[model samples]
Target: MSFLTVIASASLLAATGSDSIPRPAPSGPLVAPVALAVPFRAPVDTTKRARKAVTYSDGYYKRVAIHQALSWAMLPLFATSYVSGDQLLDKGDDAPDWAQTMHPIAATGSAVLFGANAVTGTWNLWEGRKDPNGRKRRLLHSALFIAASGGFAYAGSIADQAEENGAIRERHRNVAIASMSASTASWLIMLIGN
Candidate 1:
């Protein structure tokens, strides 16, 4: 092999952590070769390891950017609504007036966030349908998130008609539990399957 080709091969193998090549063990020796190795460093594709280190991915990452933005807008709303709604559920009409007042406000925020997330997700799916670069798993990921969001919204709607600490509340809780479980599975599938 040519000299440059040999060096590139070694660098590529090292970059990939290939163990197929054996190395001689050093025994208390200062090494000029080691000292010279720096200039032959393997070129790294930093985008694979660090998002902020480099920018640019295919169409799929455009979807990811939207997902991140929606999450930032949605998570706080979901949390606030969930906590307040739970408190209201437990205390019924006897809940502290603040809890009663905040419950609806938080729920509204959650609903708006849910709508935003859903719209962004749908947009991603539409983009994927249009793009040759779209992977099947990414489409599945968006679809699954839509289903989970729907289930969550349905649960919330059911809760609205529920009497505090009553059967309908229990049902809403059950559905919410299932929706969260599905959401976890969807995330796992996207991360690994994608």
Candidate 2:
């Protein structure tokens, strides 16, 4: 018979054998009694275990959920920044007060979104504690989000600064708008993927 078949047959025979008492003392040697122990444990308090399991699942859900939320939260800021920047460049002094106000508000919003994502992502990993893989993935997401946010923030700041100095006339403002768009898109994608 094949080796596997022989092993299987032996296992089957062993499993099917009767549970009858063994014959005592075929020879001279005396041995100590052996005890069989159960492998599975019944918990002393099952309710607590169930609660903890739910808590663990909730923690995971919250981490992913917040990241998803941050991604969405950034969309409007990005749009506002793009539209305002465009108007400022194209219409110059003719751009509405609201659009001009949006220049700073959009920059601030970008900062908030990026900062929140990084903080929350890091907190998720730290609070979870045991999953190294999850933590690594989160770290990558945090880094990307922060980098993208920083790029938009810095570029926006420079554009606004130049505007303050009458240096953001036309083409320069377009570059800032484009940079903000790319950064926001990058942040959104990173947050979504994570």
Candidate 3:
């Protein structure tokens, strides 16, 4: 009946539909319908999309754990080798029986450990080459370890000459120590970083 009521009813009917319009009561005043406020939503896209898959092998984590264990194991081996080697260097062929026996054994143990680590580490490195995370650190670790491996190999090659020559023994000792230090640094970088 009123101008505002008519306008409100017209707007409400237009917003909804004719069936949604409120009916007037016989005895009471006519009430206009209240239009519900609906929040706006963008249309959803339903097309399927592909996600990138991880490239590493199933044994990746296992190798990582093994590599870490081997790295820790290397510390004691290094200490044993260093102590026994220092004794041999100081006393030459007259070194104590334990030092004479332990030095080569420890060195051999270290070599075996390094060889195993080299295989696992290099394989893992190749597998993870595409991964962007910590790539630089991994690369540096590999480089240092490789250099240490070369140093160890050189030291091993001179072992026979080292027995007869004091100078050669000292050089061997120095090379082995430097190699151990490099490997230790490489181990520390990964341990501390992760």
Candidate 4:
């Protein structure tokens, strides 16, 4: 036999504990196979893993729908506030300085929230329909919408307080509370559901 062939045979027999190779002594206690981490375990049952992933995806889509609906609901309210502010101020040729200033402020807050909602909602929808970009898009849009909604409500509340209108102040306060609750819920759902 060639020298290379003899060496290969010797190594193979040594690896298999043949008489040609001495075996090493055990130096540690024996242990059972480790329980794999969650991701690794999933591969053991491909179908189940696929189902769970699909469920997560579907729930994400539902959240997207909810985000869209909430955005739509906000739009009309924002439109009303913005137009009412403008119309009220426009009625007087020499509007009071405070009314003139407050109207624009109110309208501006309304517009900011509505615009932010739209931008975020659209991004979220696009993300949901696509795979590679879904997670990042969803997180970003959810955050943006929450900020927009919360900021707008807070601004509206401040405006109401500025006017010294008790009923308006209370109404705005309630609205702000509701907006905060929704934002919190949306984020929680996104994290848990996904």
lDDT at position 51, candidate 1: 26
TM-score (C-alpha) between model 4 and the true structure:
0.33
Top candidate by lDDT: 3
Better of 2 and 3 by lDDT: 3
| Candidate closer to the true structure by TM-score (higher is better), 2 or 4 | 2
Q: On TM-score, who's better, 2 or 3? A: 3
lDDT of 3 at 172: 97
Runs of candidate 4 exceeding 4 Å displacement:
1-54, 57-63, 89-133, 164-194
Deviation in angstroms for 158 in model 2?
Answer: 2.5
TM-score-superior candidate, 3 or 4: 3
Q: What is the descending lDDT order?
A: 3, 1, 2, 4
TM-score for predicted model 3 compared with the true structure: 0.72
Which is the better candidate, 1 or 3, if ranked by TM-score? Answer: 3
lDDT of 1 by residue, 132-164 (tens): 443567666666777777888888788657764
Candidate 2: tens digits of C-alpha lDDT, residues 5-55: 545555766887954534333344444445887797767876333323213
TM-score of each: 0.54, 0.52, 0.72, 0.33
lDDT of 3: 0.89
lDDT string for model 3 (21-96, tens) is 6755335566766798899765667544444456777798889988999999999999999999898888887889
Which sections of candidate 3 miss by over 4 Å?
1-55
Could you tell me which residue pairs clash in candidate 3? none
- Cα deviation of 112, candidate 1, in Å: 1.6
User: Which 10-residue span in candidate 2 carries the lowest summed lDDT?
Assistant: 47-56
**lDDT tens digits, residues 1-194, model 4?**
34455566668887887785643444555344467776535355565433223223565566567655654465455544545554443454364565566656555655665665566566546544544434564665466556746665575647645456655645554564455455545555555655
